[model samples]
Target: MKQILKTILLPLFLITALSLNNCATIFSGTSQDVEINAKPQGTTIIILGGTIGKIIRYGAKIQSFIDIFSEYLDEEDKKVLERYSFESLITAVILEVRGVVPVERSMSQEVAKVLAKIPRSYKVKVLNTFGMEEFALAPVKTELKTSGGYAVIGYMSGKKIVVKEINTRLNWTILWNVLNGFILLPIDVLTGAYKKLTPLELDMELNEPGEKLSDYQAQGPNQKILILVN
Candidate 1:
C-alpha cells in the first residue's frame, strides 16, 4: 500500500514540476531587460512620439464607419481609410486635389473630391511637441514591455538626437513546452510571455548641433559632459 501511494504521488509531482519549468510564463516572463548607452554617457533617453499609436487610434474610427456602411466601401477603400488620421487624410485629399501627392490607382475619385472640400486649419510651429514621460540617464538598464513603443535619446536642452523604436518578436523558448505536450502554451500566450522585446541593447552616438569635431578633440577623449534635467 505504501509503495503504491509513493508511486502515484511521485509521478504527479514530477509532471507538475516539468510543466512549470517549461512554461515561459513561469521561467522567461513577459517583459525583457534592455541596456541602453550613449556616446555622451549622460545623455537623456525619453519615451515619446510614435506613428503606431496614431495609426491604431485612427484605425478604430475607420473600422466603426466600415461596420455601419458596409455596402459603400470595398476592401481597398477600407484599407485607405484605416491607414490615415483625420488630419493626414485631409492633407492627402488636398494634395490629391492640387496634384501634389499622386492619388493611388485604387483610391475612389468621388471620395477624394468630397474630402478635399472640408475646411483646413494650419497652426504654424517651429518645433513639433509631444508629451514627455518616463526618462532615464544613459549607461542604464531598464525593463521594457514585450509590446511595442518608441523612444528618443536627446540632450537636456530638448534637442532630439536619436529615435529608436522598440518592437516585439516571438519568444521561441515557449516551444520547450512541446515536450510537455504544449499544456502550458495557453498560459504563456494569454499572459504575453510568448513574446520578446527586440534589440535587447542600444548603443547610440549623439550628434550635437553646431559642435565641430575639433571642439570635441580639444576636450580630450576621457572628458565627460553631464547635463541634468529637472
Candidate 2:
C-alpha cells in the first residue's frame, strides 16, 4: 500500500512541475512579468487583465526590471498577484520579433513600420532589449481585438493598456474641457487624439523561421521580444 501511494504521488508531482514550467503566469489586475515575443528565441510574456501601471520600469537604458520587481514583491505589505506582476495583464495580442541586435536604431525603425500597419484600437510600443545578456526571446505576431479591453506587460517595452468604452456620457463632458481634460489620466485618448487611427496592410511572421534559420528544431536566445494577447 505504501509503495503504491508513493508511486502515485511521484507521478502527480512530476506532472504538476511540468505544467508549471510550460506556461507563464496570468495576473488578475494591473501587473505582470511580460516579454514581447520579438524573435525566433523563446521569450516569455505574462499578462494580467486590468490597468497597466506606469512605464517607468522599461525603456532605453533599463538594467534589471526583474530585480526591481522582485524587490517590490519582497516588501512587507506588497504582494505579486498569483498570475503575474502588477504591470501587465490587459493585453489583446503580442508581437514578438527576432534576428537583429536589440540596440540597433534600425530595429526600432523597422518595428515602427510594423506598428503603422496595426489597427488603431491596438496599443503598441517598442520593447527594449538593452540588458538581455541571455538567449534571444521568442516572439509572436499579433492581431488586435477591438471589442475588448487590453493590457501589455513584457521585457523592456513600455507598459500599454487599452479598453473599450464607446463614447460614454462622462467622456462627452470630458472632451468639452480639452485643456483641463488633457491633465487627466488617459491624455491622448481622452482628448480625442485617438479618433484618427488607421490599420496598416502588413504581415509579421517569425523572422528566423521565414529565413529558414530556425536551426531545424533548435531555438536560440538572441531572439527579440515575447508576446501575449487576449
Top candidate, metric lDDT:
1
TM-score, every prediction:
0.32, 0.19
Candidate 2: global Cα-lDDT? Answer: 0.25
- TM-score, cand. 2 vs. native: 0.19
**Candidate 1 clashes between residue pairs 3 or more apart in a chain or in different chains:** none
Q: What's model 1's overall lDDT?
A: 0.38
lDDT of 2 by residue, 1-230 (tens): 99998764543333222222221211122222322343223433332222221222221111222333233233322222222222221121133234322222212333233323433333232232221112223453333322222232233232222111111012222223332323211114465321211221111223322111111221112111111111
lDDT of each: 0.38, 0.25
Candidate 2 minimal-lDDT segment of 10 residues: 161-170
Q: How many clashing residue pairs appear in each of the predictions shown? A: 0, 49
RMSD of 2: 23.3
List the candidate 1 regions with Cα displacement exceeding 4 Å: 1-28, 49-133, 156-160, 169-199, 208-230
Clashes of 1: 0
